[model samples]
Target: MTVITGPLAKQERDDTGALLQSTLVDLLDLSLLAKQAHWNVYGPRFRAVHLQLDEVVTTARDYADQVAERAAALGVSPDGRAGTVAENSGLPAFVSGWVDDGKVVEAIVQVFSTLITRMRARIDEAGRSDAVTQDLFLSLAAALEKQSWMFQAENRA
Candidate 1:
């Protein structure tokens, strides 16, 4: 078990730091997955899909930076290396090959589902820590759920 020895207690800030650290790994994985889809996606909607996927990766990178800096503030070591990210991420292993548009969306949906699940789990962990972490997680959880809902909505339409 990782023991925190800093002056800060295991309250909202620590919980927030942990969540951010964990989320960073997933965001990095998402960025890479988006890139993979961008490169190999084919059939109809190739250009649009590829461009959009590229855009998501770009956005995710910025999110990763924020999470990494937050994690650092709490004096926790970040699993920022590619190998560490692969090991830490909750997203399933990516299946290689040219993915059809629907399959691409489905795969991304699965990844998002896992991400939302992990985020909720971290929120629970924050509860054990205290109110501040809980509130921070509440905010992030809401945002993540909204994003997940949008992804699910796209697939349903």
Candidate 2:
């Protein structure tokens, strides 16, 4: 089988590929979590929180595509399969059944907080080997941070 290759050294490629693959799993699972929350969220703020969930889903999906493509470009296969995401993702699962808006907002804030921390570490790791991958992580981090801030705002009095 022919393997795709990039400019980074073997070790660099391996490191960056691992980072991309991990981030891909996180993004895919996050999008699924947001969609679940979007569909089942209720309560007085339901409309606003439901709409916001869609935004998060969009952001996560967009970044997932970029991360996967980045991995492929580096000759690494990105495994975003459901089993992979379920097995590899460190993010917590959303509660089953109807969730109140307050709970959804609180849960998302926690999830984003965790993800942002990991994304920062990814940015640092990728920076050591590939600026190209690091740049993608940076943009994704910015978008996630913005969404996180929005979610945080929802929980505030």
What is the Cα-based lDDT of residue 148 in candidate 1? 55
Worst 10-residue lDDT window, candidate 2? 1-10
Which stretches of candidate 1 lie above 4 Å from their native place?
A: 1-7, 10-17, 130-143
The weakest ten consecutive residues by lDDT in model 1 span: 1-10
Q: How close is candidate 2 to the true structure, as a TM-score?
A: 0.97
The residue-by-residue lDDT of candidate 1 on 1-157, one tens digit each, is 4544444566655566667778888889989988888788886767766676776686678767766765665666667898888788878866798888767767877877887788788778867765554565566567556655655665634
Best by TM-score: 2
* Local error of candidate 1 at residue 88 (angstroms): 1.8
* Candidate 2 Cα outliers beyond 4 Å, as residue runs: none
Candidate 2 local lDDT, 122-143, one digit each (tens) = 9999999999999999999999
Clashes of 2: 0
At residue 40, candidate 2 shows an lDDT of 99
